[model samples]
Target: MSKIDLRKNIVQYMLERKQLAHISARVGIVLDITGSMQGLYKNGTVQEVVERILAVASKFDDNGALDVWVYDHEFSRLPAVTEQDFNSYVTTQILKNKNIHKFGRNNEPLVMEDVIKKYTVEEQSSLPAFIIFINDGGAVKSTKKVIVESAIQPIFWQFVGIGNSDFEVLKKLDSMEGRIVDNANFIHLEDISAVSDEMLYDQLLNEFPMWIQAATEKRIIR
Candidate 1:
């Protein structure tokens, strides 16, 4: 399919699901660039997901752009991705040199800390933030600490595990103690392409609105 048509289909799918209809939060995409994800990046799975998520961000984010970060042992922000430049952006910034494969570790807490510090503690925007964190394996030990600490912030973490690897840490996040509220959700995708858009959207978004409401009651978000 042509890139334009693919983009349209993604937008249409999100609209049909009302994924962006009731939310007005900034969207951030935290992609795991570990070695395990090399196949997904090379096979265009990551590219397609980025495009679809950008469609939702365009409707919900005030800037109509997605703040992207790629993490391995650490993390760094990429240029903001929008529908118009997403194709060229990924080609030049991520796919051309196979940069996504360069990262060798999977320290998820670092990425979480960076986002929370930047968006919650520093900028302090009134609108809540929705963070889409994609990973294929478990995170470092520090991830639990960071996640529990982040429960008080105005952010919702949607964790998508894109492979068959055991996601023990993510699976136990909801039951972990000391969290102000359950601010994270995990969904495993064995075959990302085979998953229908409706199912993917439902899994990716199911717990976010509840977190928003809970965070508001706790004064994490205004």
Candidate 2:
């Protein structure tokens, strides 16, 4: 089926199941778009990895709000301030000039900082917000520790490793057994960047169901 149709069907299915309410999650996606991501991999190109991520994020059909933000160091500066600016960076800056940035190499610090700033001081009395960080490597600055420490409590952080970068850092941070992080835990992935388009699609298709399971457990969806 078409992407739109698939998304609509998924949403409709959840609604019919009375579980749509449980799917309400404010998901914030922090994507790294540095130049090094363009490196050749055994499975596919770096661009392919990015496309896969976008596809996964876009295909998410839950009722919870979705915010996708991408960061790259080519524009100079550690973090790009303002969502409007960050959005513009993806559509205008990065889309127009794709040669300068690598994926996770140089953009981690900026992206992390930007993400933290986006929801750091917000007063959340209801549901906890979900933040997913997908990068290929490490951070440039020591911003993660400070941001993680200062950010208001009760935030769920997820890290997805894309390339040859060290995923051990993610393991150290994750407290949960599964990918679901409850109340200030980290969830991460190893290098799944080398998969082909078909493989990537299958992987994502398998993973999407977990989002529903987590949302249900959290009572975000029915």
How much is 191 displaced in model 1, in angstroms? 1.3
**Would you list the clashing residue pairs of candidate 1?**
none
**Per-residue alpha-carbon lDDT of candidate 2 for residues 39-80, written as tens digits (9 for 90 to 100):** 432224433333444333343423323455666663322232
Candidate 1: residue 208 lDDT (0-100):
79
Q: Tell me how many clashing residue pairs each candidate has.
A: 0, 16
**Model 1 over residues 1-222: C-alpha lDDT tens digits?**
865456546655664575446668899999888878888888788888887778668767889889998888867778889867887565577767454445588888777888998796777889988989888886776788888888888888888887888888888777889998888888888787888766776677778767877888898888
Once model 1 is optimally superposed onto the true structure by TM-score, how far is the C-alpha of residue 91 displaced, in angstroms?
Answer: 2.4
Error of 1 at 175 (Å): 0.8
Assess every candidate by TM-score.
0.88, 0.53
Query: Which is the leading candidate under lDDT?
Result: 1
